[model samples]
Target: MKFEHVILGLLSWRPFSGYELAKHLEVEGRFLKNKVHLSQIYRLLSRMVDSGWVSYQVSVNDGRPDSKIYRLTASGEQVLRDWVTGPYEPSTRFQDPEFMVRFTFGGPLDHDALLRLIRTELECRRAQVARFRTRDRTITDLDPIEGVDTAMVDRVRELSHLHGAASIDAWIDWLQRMLTELGGTVPSTG
Candidate 1:
């Protein structure tokens, strides 16, 4: 997901100064972005302003620097809506922030769009589970250097594979449940 989309999503909540934006990102919006520097937020805001997607108004404080409180322009709203309603390409990393980001922003904006996003994620994760659930995880050592614990390596590899498979399966199950709640058809897991 583009960083701008994240910013747009935040703005959709309410107009915020750059500092507030940073604070929001650090707290409530952390899932969307773990760590974003203050300067980067300002820079992106400036770019959005230039693109005619964002506009800001300066607010004077009694004993502080003037703050530019940012808001989305009509163009920005359209862009955000288009992006939310557009196709979602699932990330290979099952727990990537992409799903959370899209859902947080898009789900509230449009119902059908939310269903589409969830459906896309569900299908992708289902495919991933089918592809990797029972794959052979054998590790072949070819002339390994001394001191390498081949057995330990194999155990770790198998554990990691199992962990990933289980995580994706759980995600798919949640998606199915969510689709049901949203009145979307839950596809067969076969």
Candidate 2:
């Protein structure tokens, strides 16, 4: 996931102090990313400022160092909109965190966008299932190898495929549910 997009999304909600943003990552936003160091957050914030995507004001406290509070600028809003509505290509792995981030931040922004995301995912996962469901698991001993069991290798491969299929099937079902919740019809898997 592009970490900057997450930052832009959060800033769209409201102005957040650097400390508040870090706390958000530690708490509710942890699923998007795990344990972002404070220094890294500040550096990204500085970059955002330089890019004119966000502007910050220093808030001074009595007998303590000042803090930077960040809010999204107009350009930042447009950048975020572009990202939210942008093309999404699924990673090779299923249940990727990027999907969750996009869904969480983009779904509320627009219904059609969410629908598009769900449809794309559903199509891809269904294709994956169709492609992987049946395969030629033929094992050949063309060359003599030491300590290798073709039967064992075949069994392990089957087990791994089964595990992956189960997980992806569950993911598909969940996506279908989400589509229904969004008032969109689920596409036929046939």
Candidate 3:
């Protein structure tokens, strides 16, 4: 899914400033591939406003600069609903960067080439889980602080890493099984 959809999904929950939206992405139970900065959010918000998918209000807070709070419009809600209910079209352009990289190098890469890519991805995910576990362990060793929600954040990160790792493992297994069923070989590169 596009970042646009994710932004819309957040707005669907409630109106928020661009900064607030970035925070929600950081803290919420969503898989964050990277830390989203406020500038990126504001750029997307601007495009969304121009597209009439979202509306915003500029208001001043006491002791603060003017902020634009954004909300999804009816049209935006319809667009989101349509996206959710629409037929799935696998978008090569939208594929993850690693996947795209493999595809770009796949001219002479045959079935075994694809399987190797999957295996490599699985290994990367395993390393990711290890890193996340280490981070979680480090967090656990910290002394508790009042009003700090470190534990909750750690739990979210742990689960996200675990789930993501499990998913990659599952895909790896499925691909290996399929390769085996296909006589342990993919079509030869011509």
User: What is model 3's C-alpha RMSD?
Assistant: 15.0
Residue pairs with backbone overlap in model 1: none
Q: Please report how far candidate 1 places residue 162 from its true position, in Å.
A: 2.1
Model 2: per-residue lDDT, tens digit, 93-122? 777877888888888887898899988888
Q: For model 2, which pairs clash?
A: none
lDDT of 3: 0.62
Q: Which stretches of candidate 2 lie over 4 Å from their true place?
A: 138-155
Residue 123's lDDT within candidate 3 is: 49
lDDT minimum window of 10 residues, candidate 1? 135-144
What would the TM-scores of all predictions be?
A: 0.94, 0.86, 0.48
Candidate 3's residue-wise lDDT over 1-190, tens digit each? 4677777766777899988888877886235325788799899999999999999999888997888999999998777655544333332222253343332223123455545554444444445445554453345466667876886878886787677657755754664565466445533322
Using TM-score, give the best candidate's number: 1
lDDT of each: 0.87, 0.87, 0.62
User: TM-score for model 2?
Assistant: 0.86
The segments of candidate 3 whose C-alpha lies over 4 angstroms from its true place after superposition are 29-33, 89-190
Q: Tens-digit lDDT track for model 1 on 1-190?
A: 8899999998888899999999998998888887999999999999999999999999999888889999999999999999998888888887678788888899889989998888888888888777877787675655668997878777888888778777777887888899998889987776
Supply the global lDDT for candidate 1. Answer: 0.87
User: Which scores greater on TM-score, model 1 or model 3?
Assistant: 1
